[model samples]
Target: MTQVKKHEAKLSRAVESIQPSGIRRFFDMASSMENIISLGVGEPDFTTPWSVREASIHSLESGRTSYTANAGLIELREAISDYMEERFDVSYRPEDEVIVTVGASEGIDIALRSVVDPGDDVLIVEPCFVSYAPLVSMAGGQPIPVPTFMKDDFQVTLETLQEKITPKTKAIMLSFPNNPTGGVMGREDLEKLRDFIIEHDLVVLSDEIYAELSYDQEHVSTAAIDGLKERTILISGFSKSFAMTGWRVGYVCAPAAYAAAMLKIHQYAMMCASTMAQYAALEALTNGRQEMEEMITSYRQRRNFFVKSLREAGLSCHTPGGAFYAFPSIKASGLSSEQFAEQLLLEQHVAVVPGHVFGEGGEGHIRCSYAASMAQLEEAVDRIAVFMNTIKKEG
Candidate 1:
C-alpha cells in the first residue's frame, strides 16, 4: 500500500498576507526578560474602578449570567446613548442604532466586514493602531494608507485624503486620539474631513476609544459633524477611559441601517458582549465618572512629564494632545525605530514599540506609552537617556 504524502495546509491568502502585531512581539520579548520597565502596551496601570468591579460582582451574585440580546442589554445601550450625547455630542437611538460588542476591536471588525466587499478600498490614516490595516485586509478590502506626518501633528488633511481616494474607496477608518502617534483632530479639522467624506460618499468608521482622554481640547465626534452622521459608524469602549481592558466591553453607534448590518454580523460571530462586562460598563457610565476623570488627570500629568523627559533625553517628541503615548523621533540616535527599540530593550531593559509597526510615515520614530506609574516613567526615562548617550557615542 502506498503511504499518503502529507502536505502543508493552505491558509487563506488574506491571513497569509497579514503580519503579526508588532506591539505584541515586543511585549512578548519584554515578558521573557527580568527587571524590564515596559512602556509598550497601552493599558492603564490603574485598576478598574472599584465601583465598576463591584457592579460586575453584584451581577454574578444576582445570577444574570445568561447571554444578552445580540444588541445587548437595552439599559446599557440607553446609558451608552446618553453618554455619547453628553460627552461627545453624538446622539443615536439606543433601541436600534447601538450594539454592545466584545470590545471596540470587535466593533471595528464587524464594521469592516459589514461594508467592505472584496477588493474595495478603505483609507486608513496612519500612523495608527496596528489593528486597522490588518483588519481591513482580513475583510478582503485594500488597506490604503494615507500617511500623516509630524509636521501636521499626524492629523489627516483633505489634501492627504484626496491623494488616496479612488472610486472604489468605500470607507475611511479614523482613530483619534490615535494610538501610536497620539494625534487628535479638532472640530475644524474634522469639518474638512466631513466635506471630503460627503463628496466621496464614503462611510466613516470613527474609532473614538480615546475620546474621553483628550488633554488639550474636546474630542469632537466625527459623526457629530454636519452631514457626516448618516454615514458614520462610531466605535468606542470602556477599555481606555474606564480602565476596562480585561473586561472586553465596547460598543458601536451608527445610523439605523449600518447598525443593523453590523448587528447581524455580531449576532452570529459574538452573540453579545459578556453579560457581567455589560453590567460593569453600565455602572461605569452611571457612577464611575469621578474615578474615570481622576485617571484622565493622572494620564495628562504623565503625558506632560514623559514628553518633556523624552525631549531632554535628546529625542524629539511632539506633545501628544490625547491618549497616553509619546511618538518620539529616534532618528537622532542614528538607528531605525526597530533597532533603537531592540537595543534599548537589550541594554537598558526598557521596552517601547517601534513606530514602523503602525505603518506608513511611522519609521524613524518609537512609541512609548505613558500609562505606567510615575515611578516607572522616571526610571524608564533615565534608562533611555543612558541608551541615547551610548548610541550617540558609537555614532
Candidate 2:
C-alpha cells in the first residue's frame, strides 16, 4: 500500500465558507507602509476618559481582578438600567433583563444565537457593520440582505422591509448611527419598522453601539417605542461614546425569556466581562458625561468640516448625521470602489475602505473615517483631491 501523505486537519465548513474581512486587508497593508494615514478602521481616536481609566486602575489596585456574576456585577447592571431609563425612556429590570458581555460585538452574537434557529432567515440592513451577516450565518440561520438606497439617505423603509420578508424570515438586525454609511433612522422611519415587525410576528436585534455619537439629532432607541420593548434586544457599550474600545464592555437588554437564554450561553462561553472594565464603565456612566459631550462636539465639527471638504473635492457624499464615517460615491472617478481605494493607497498613502466590503449595496462608494485629527483630515483630503483629478484626467 502506498504511504498516505499527511495533511493539516480540516476546518469546519461554517468557518471556511465565510470570506475574510475586507476591511482588514487594506488595514494590514496600510500598517506595513510608512507614513500611511489609515481611514480604514472604525474606532474613535480619543483616549479613554481619565476618570474612567483611574477607576479601572483603582479597581486593579484594590484586587478586583476576579470575575463577577455571569450576568455581570449587579451594580453595573443597575447603572445600565437607570442610564437607559433616564436617557431613552427604556426600562429594564437589572436582575433578569440585562447581561453584560465582552463587548457589544459579543452581545450581538449571543442575541442572534439565542433567538435564531436553523433554517430561519435573519434580515440584515446593509450596508451595515460587516459582522451582522457573518454572525447570523454562524448561528445556523440564513443571512438575508436588505439593501437601503443612497438616494434615500440609506434609511430602511417599510416597503424595503416588506419586500424582503419570507415565511422563513424570523428576525431583523439593525445598526444606526450605522458603520460605513453613518445613516441614522428617524423616529418616523423606526415606527414604520415597528409596525412591520409586529404584523409579521418577528423579533428585533438593534445594535445601538454608536447611539451616543449622533451629530445632527438625538439618538432614538427602538425599545422605547410602544409595543417594541418586549420584542427588541438592545445592544450598546462604552466603546464609542466613552472611547473605551479596548475596555471591551457592553450590555444587552431583552425580555426575561430571551435574556435568560443569552445568559445561558454567556455563563458557559464567557463567564463574565472583565471586572476592571465593569468598574471603569461604571465611572464612565456616572462621571464621564461632560467628557462625552466634548468628544461628540468635536466629532460634529469634524463631520461638518470633512464632509464639506469631500464635496469640495468633487466627491458626492451625503452629509452623515451621525457616526465617524462618510460614505462618498466614487462612481464619477471612473473606477470601482476597490480600484479607487487601492490606487489611492498606493499613490497617495491615504488608506480608506472600499464600500463593497460592506455588502451588495456598497459598490461605487468608499468609507472615509473623519475620526483622525483636523490636520490629518486636511492632508488626506488634499491627497484624495489630487488622486481624483488624476483619475478624471486619465478617464
Candidate 3:
C-alpha cells in the first residue's frame, strides 16, 4: 500500500469520519489575499480588559506559574460560583459542582464524553457554534442536528425538539446568544422546553459564552430555568466577553454527579487550565465589569450600523439581538452561500463566512461579524453593496 494510504489507515476512524471546520477554510483564504476586509472571525476585536491582563502579570511576577488543582484554583471556582449566582440567578458549588477548563471548548468535550455512551443520540440546535456536532461525534455519540430557522429568529421550539427525540436520545446541546445567527432565547421562549426536558429526563449542554454580550435584554441562563439545573451542564468562557481569546480559560457548572464524571476525564487529559489564566479570570470576576460594559456598548453601536447597512444594501437580515454577527440572506444575488462569500472575497476584497458552514439551516445566508472597527464595517458594507450591484447587472 502507498505510504499516504498506510498513514490514513493508522488514523482513528472516528477522527477520519468528522469534517474539518469550514469556517477556517474561508479565514485561511482571506489571509492569503491582500486588502481583504474580513468579518469572518467570531471573537471580539477588543483587547483583553486591562485589569484582567494586569492580574496575569502580577501572577507571573509573584512566581505563580505552577499548575492549579485539577478542578482549578479554589478561589477562581468560588468566584465563578458567586458571579453566576449574583449576575444570572444560577448557583453552583465551587467545591464539587464547578470545574475550570482549558476553554469552554474543553468543557464541552469533557461534558459530552462524561454523559454519552457509544451510539447515543445528542440533539444539537443549529445554526450553532461549529464545534458542537464534531465534539458530539468525537465522544462516540450520534449528533442529531435539530435545525432552527431565521423566520423563528433561530429559537429552538418544543415542537421541533419533540420531532427529533427518540429512545436513543441522550442529551441536547444549546448555544445562545447563538454563534453565527446571533439569536438569544428569552425566558418565555426557554420556558417552552421545560416540560419536554422534564419528560425526557435528558441532559442539556448549554454553551453561553456570549452571555454578557446580548443587546437590549439580559441573557437567560438555561440552567436558571427550574428543573434544568440538575440536568444542564453550563459552559462559558472569557474569550468572547472579556476579549481574552488567548487566555485559554473557561468553565463548566454542572450538578455534582455530572461534574465528578467530567472531572475524571479532565484530570487525566488536561491536568489543569493555565494557572495564570485562572488568576486573570478571578480578577475579571472581581473588577472587570465596567470594562466589559464599555466593550458591549461599542459592539451594540457597531451591530446597529452594520445591520442597517446590510438591510439598505437589499440583503434581508434579522437584526441580531445578541453576539456580534449579522446573518444576511444573500439569495437575492442568485448565489449559494459559498458562491456569494467566495465571489465577494475575490471581487470586493471582503471576507465573510458562508452561512452553510454553520449548519444546514444556514444556507442562502452569510455571517458578517460586526466585531471589526466601524471604519472597516462601513468599508465592508460599501464593498458588499458594489458586489451586489455587480451581480445584479450580470443577472
Per-model TM-score versus the true fold: 0.98, 0.98, 0.97
Error of 2 at 350 (Å): 0.5
Give the per-residue lDDT of model 1 (tens digit) for 269-309.
Answer: 98999999999999999999999999999999999999999
Off by over 4 Å in 1: 5-7
lDDT for 67 (candidate 1):
92
Clashes of each: 0, 0, 0
Q: Rank the candidates by TM-score, best first.
A: 1, 2, 3
On a 0 to 100 scale, what is the lDDT of residue 379 in model 1? 100
lDDT digits (tens) for residues 36-141 of candidate 3? 8999988888988888999999999999999999999999999999999998999999999999999999999999999999999999999888888898888999
What C-alpha lDDT do the candidate models reach, one value each?
0.93, 0.92, 0.93
Task: Return the lDDT, model 2, position 390.
Answer: 90
- List the candidate 2 regions with Cα displacement exceeding 4 Å: 1-7
Q: Assess candidate 1 and give its lDDT.
A: 0.93
Candidate 1, position 229, lDDT:
93
- Top candidate on lDDT is 1
**Clashing residue pairs in candidate 2 (N, C-alpha, C atoms within 3 angstroms):** none
lDDT of 3 at 345: 93
- Candidate 3 TM-score, C-alpha based: 0.97
